[model samples]
Target: QAGPGTIGRIVRVLLAEWNRFGQQVMMDGRVIQRGWRETQRGFDDRVGLFWRYGTGINLDGDDTDHPWSAAFISYTMRTAGVPDHLFPRSRRHSTYIHFAQQNALVNDPDTAFIAHRLEAYAPKVGDLVAYTRSGAANYDRYVNRARYKSHTDIVTYVHHGEIGVIGGNVADSVTLKRLKRGGAGRLIDDSHAWFAVIENRLPLR
Candidate 1:
């Protein structure tokens, strides 16, 4: 069960956080807060959504995957003493964050900060991870590697109390099958892919 009062309080806190630390815009000599916006990654064929406002944004696919987003939302609910199921699992292609109100929402740093903070409450497994680098230098290299060898995304599954993160130097990947199998097979010598046990279950927040 969710505490109706607490839920409202949490919403107010989040809204206030957005209004204060979030990005602001001046329109008609009035300062307005922006909450969040949908951002696209890949292209028409491999497009995905993330939330952004101002210069701060989190990408869904390349930023992190569905399971990760679920974990974050779950954590947030738990922190608010709400039922974990209140934050339902979403499809891989669905938006990471959704809102019933649009007028008060503006994609901005506050949304990104709060979302990124939720990872501390209810963590889960089999999440996609990404880096926040800005450049295209390695794009050609990754694409070429996938073209010449295998194409797969760098992701991992935390199964049976063990965590396995897949890493690959390939481009054009949308799944983690190859990184898992290859790492298990020892086909490659070293890997940026990482796997470890969850010693600490604390959420990022």
Candidate 2:
């Protein structure tokens, strides 16, 4: 098991990465766009790094055909010192999402995360919030059969009536999004059809 400070380290790494992308913010249906984007000149190197280090792919960030959001999440986990055995790094978010779901289904002790239905779990800092991005995908959709278009954001802050999450490739940049919560302190569905919240089970300080 990771030491008690692992979760803290993860949060710190996430915030630092967010700062590197110029601290873009999205809140209350309004987007504050101000940051380096993957396609922007002079910033492609960073995105490229995400692909190489996160997914072992040499594709350039400006390659519009290949989205780097999942790579960004993988990069964050790798940079945070998560062991490969505990966190699966992949170019597609569905890979790791499915792994977490399997962990929960089997009660795997070696995994660092467990997938929970949105209503069954209230995400905290260091957890991941996931949503489907296309075609009939939802919480019950089986992810192992094939790739599903989806996205996930790391939970960075949880406070009264709101929670803040940071994701990459949002608006073409690493963006911090603030979302409102329902009376139960759970996320409210919006344009994104949220399905699961991958709980961070690592020891937290």
Candidate 3:
């Protein structure tokens, strides 16, 4: 079983890492302090996660050719000691977003888990918010793959109706982004960068 406060512990690790090196600067970690949120990939390489998950690809370094946000998420999960079978390791946001939806708490109510529609869900610490760049005119098209590229971030704090998330590869660094909800308590669809938030439920510690 995961230790007491396992979820909190994982979040703490992420927060601590952000505090130490996750600053917003172009190619920040190019010299010293080997870190993940650097211009070059730190220790969190993508090959291990993908290969472990049977992706058959071995990615190396912080190569721009290989986006490392997916690798970053996989690293977080590995550091948290989440089992391989529980999460899908991939470069695309859809790989895990679909899994979270399928395994949402609505389908399995006993576990402390759930996924919610981005426009309708409340921001929670440790929740994941996935966004598509598809420029969807409505909610229906937002989830489709016409435009298809996407990004995902981890929500870390909530206050006064706005939520803060830590995401990798923003402005070329690991940075904290603040998000505002619409008057109806939903994500505003007018934003260019984000379209949806997927809450990946964690088992109670």
Candidate 4:
């Protein structure tokens, strides 16, 4: 498992990228479109870098045929020096989500991430919050390593009844989303069918 410093590094990397993308924020269930988008001039190259680091693909941001949201998460984790064994870079969020689920099932001490039901854990900085987009998506579906459409965001901060998460390809750029915390400090967002929060098990500094 990665140490607390690694988790700190991951959060720093994500915040730095967010700033680079103009510090866009999504609040009150509305998107804030103030920053650079993936297709905009002078910004496509950055998206290309995400693709390169996440998928080893040379595709540019203007190529909308491929969604780069997962790539963005991969890039962030990899750039933060997360080990491939703990957090494998992938083009799909389901890959790491599934991996985390397996780690939870086995209670693997070496795994940096462990998946838990939304009610089971309150997310912390560097943890991942994942949700399903399709009607067929469910927690059991990922146990078999099945391909599914999903999205994940890294938790940047947690406050009273609120949490800040950052994700790539949101509103066509890297964006920060503010979500409400429900009873018992659990995360609740009616906008998406959230299934899991991959807890960061790395020791805190």
Candidate 5:
């Protein structure tokens, strides 16, 4: 197992990568000045992982024909040196989401994750927010990321009434979003298909 300061290390690594991905428009969540075209090609850089450690395609980010959001999240976790057992290296959001769900259900205190409903939790930095972009209310029933089309973002910063998160495949690149929250610092309905936040309990170590 990692030492006491492991979670903080992970958070720092995640935020650094978010910064490398580029700047963001915190008020809304998309990158405005840094050539939105840049978001389109970030995935080509990680195509190797998706290809079983082989080379990635030269495909552009705007190619909605293939979504690399899951790959981007996996790349971040793997790059941060997260233990393979605690997190799955997957190209599907449902895969990791399932891993988190399984652990949460068992109340596995030894692990570093706890999945909660969107309204039940106030996400902090390094935590993951998964969405059912279709606005489906039955999201809780879907046990896997592949069960439906889902997206995820890593919380990088939190400010007044907003949680700043960065994830891949938004607006055709790795984009950051400032998700709105209520007066109590709880996330409000932002009409963006968000369903749950996978709190990184490990960060609290």
Candidate 6:
């Protein structure tokens, strides 16, 4: 297994490639100017386009596989070119009920299992983005669809528009539940996973 600081090395390599991409953005005059001057944005979060969602495993043995956000950063890394061997394309049985149902596996299969392996892992600015729905692997189509009802996987660019607030909705469904119930209904509280880039702010908190 890789050491604890392995992720840091991965981040360094990713940033190197991103800086090259940034030059092109600058030449194209597409880079956005943040209001704050002391922050540095992240490549995955700052990419012109991005995505957000949740996947989970069994958290409380409640049989309910809710969404969590572990894969967000990992997927971003995979898409960003950390090496396919490092982050393979494995089918998350716990996250996708559809996959599990089709395969007829136990309801609570291994908490985290990777099915398909990837030959290459390089996340570009426009790669599809997803997060661990619930930090485990349990994610339902209905919940994911509802969470991302208004967005698409093809991200164009990160803007400070309404999406900034709603973008995080995918990770925290309660945010939407509250909005729908006139702020009166009890929200299904769940952990959130956020992957965003601020021009000057760091990506990982």
TM-score of each: 0.23, 0.92, 0.71, 0.94, 0.79, 0.24
Alpha-carbon RMSD to native, per candidate? 19.1, 1.8, 5.5, 1.6, 3.6, 16.7
User: Each model's C-alpha lDDT?
Assistant: 0.26, 0.83, 0.57, 0.86, 0.65, 0.25
**Per-candidate clash tally:** 12, 0, 1, 0, 4, 42
Using lDDT, give the best candidate's number. Answer: 4
Model 3: how far residue 89 lies from native, Å: 2.2
List, residue by residue over 35-131, the lDDT tens digit for candidate 2: 7777877668888998999989997667878999999988888887787788889888888888888888899676789998887778899999988
lDDT string for model 6 (1-205, tens) is 3334343443443344333333222111122321211112433232222123112222321112432222333344454444433333222412332232322234333312112111122122222223333343233332322223112121222322211111111322101111111122211122232121111111221
Q: How well does candidate 6 score on lDDT at residue 126?
A: 26
Q: Model 1 over residues 70-166: C-alpha lDDT tens digits?
A: 2222333344454433333222111222220111134332221112111222213323322212232122222212112111121233343223332
Q: Which stretches of candidate 3 lie over 4 Å from their true place?
A: 1-3, 25-37, 40-61, 104-106, 110-113, 137-147, 182-185, 203-205
Which candidate number maximizes TM-score?
Answer: 4
On lDDT, the stronger of 2 and 3 is 2
Model 1 TM-score, 2 decimals: 0.23
Candidate 5 lDDT, 1-205, residue by residue in tens: 5456555666666566556556544344435545243333554453334334211344444445777777777667656657668777666777777778777779878877667777777888788988775557454676544455777888877888888777766665556677897877676746476777888865444
Q: List clashing residue pairs in candidate 5.
A: 29-177, 39-173, 40-61, 94-145
The residue ranges of model 4 lying beyond 4 angstroms of the native Cα positions read 1-4
Q: Which stretches of candidate 6 lie over 4 Å from their true place?
A: 23-86, 89-139, 142-205
TM-score result, candidate 2: 0.92
